[model samples]
Target: MRNKKQRIAAMCAVLAKNPNKLYSLNYFQEMFSAAKSSISEDAAVIKQAFEDVGIGRIETVAGAHGGIRYIPSMPQAARVLLLKELTEKMTDTSRILPGGYMYIADLFCTPYYVDGMAQIMAEWFVGARADFIVTVETKGIPLAMSVARILNLPLAIARRESKLTDGSVFSINYLSGSSRRLQTMSLSKRMIREGTRALVIDDFIAGGGTVKAICDMLGEFMIEVVGIAAAIVNRYPQKKRISGYRAIFELEELSETKIEISAC
Candidate 1:
């Protein structure tokens, strides 16, 4: 038989893996062969520990549909520290491409970094309770998918070109604010339901043209954009097409000889 401390650790692990899910006390009582009161006490211990660490929180809902659920969180200090580390890594001059853009493919390809970034973004909009995560296809898919997994929500991708694979699609054309050219973005009609809340996520934001275009397209479907998050935000143009977005890193300076980055 597992001891009280062992049981509590196991329960915390289960709750962490399935965040935002409710589990009845009776279910855990049976699972651990303990009384309801004993299980509740164990939960209290775990909750205090979670609060102390600042890594996350455990919410106990009351009443019939109530149970304990784990909510991921990060301290402000920890968030700033992680962003600073990422900024240092991005200072490599070799990452500067032909254009002013810095090569960030390595950051996206690394699962450890992606997971950390996704946690930060998820924490930023946890209160929104978004129904869906929206992003442009390809590059933004990984980051969007990560947030979707954390929130246990569906992901909707806006494609560069409409395809037969997505039957009965909706398309929109808008000018790329940065490139000063027109572009088309598409999404399947069936993928997004009407009047649902969505969180917009992407790997990078430059002039906010793509994100603004996506928000406009979602408007046609009566979807609400609760928030926008990006891994990197370029500092050029000074003003962006979209407002109220969060980013982990902001590009401060970029040149042939050196690159500068800062936490955003």
Candidate 2:
């Protein structure tokens, strides 16, 4: 039989791996071969530890169907630190492309940065009770997928091309904020249900045209956009096409030989 400490550690590992998933006390009691009282005590310890370390949150739901679930959250201090580190790394002038765009494909592909950024973004919309996480195709999918996993929500990707395999698709044309060109994005009719709440996430936002177009498409399905977020927001244009969105980093300045970034 596992000792009390061993049981607690094992339970903590399970909860951490499955964020926002409910686990009944009885389930733990049977798994650990312990009494309900002992299981509760073990959970309490794990909860306290998580709180003290500021890693995340352990919520205890009461009632017959109630149990425990871990909510992935990063403390403000940790969030700021992570954004700061990312800002420093991204400020390297070499990352700036000829089109005045900063290269961040590597960061989105890296699990360390993706997970950190997703956790911070997910925390922002936890209270919004979003039904689905939505993002544009290509770059935003990775970060949006991570956020969906953390929040235990489904992810829907809007594609640049509407494939016939997708069946009936809803398409929209919006001006690209940065490129100043009209672009089309589409989503399958079956991808999301009406009257649902969606949280929009993107890897980068410039004039915010892409995200705004995404929101407009969701609106066609009667899906409400609860929140919008991005890993980086360009400081230029002074005004974005969309409002009330949050970002981890702000691109303060960018040039072929110079780049400046700051944590938002």
Query: What 10-residue stretch in candidate 2 is worst by lDDT?
Result: 72-81
Write the residue-wise lDDT of candidate 1 on 1-264 in tens digits: 369988987898888887767788887898999998999998899889988988688888899988888887777787777777788789978788887667888888677677779888998888998999999988778888888877778899999998999999989898887888999999999899999999999998889999999999898889999999999888887799999999988887888878988876
Best by lDDT: 2
TM per candidate comes to 0.93, 0.95
- Mind giving the per-residue lDDT tens digits that candidate 2 earns over 1-264? 469999988999999999998999999988988999999898889989999988887899999999999987787797777777787789877788888777879999999889999998888888899999999899889999999999999998889998989899889998999888989998888889999999999998989899999998888778999999999888988899999999988888898898888878
* TM-score of decoy 1: 0.93
Best by TM-score: 2
In TM-score terms, candidate 2 sits at 0.95
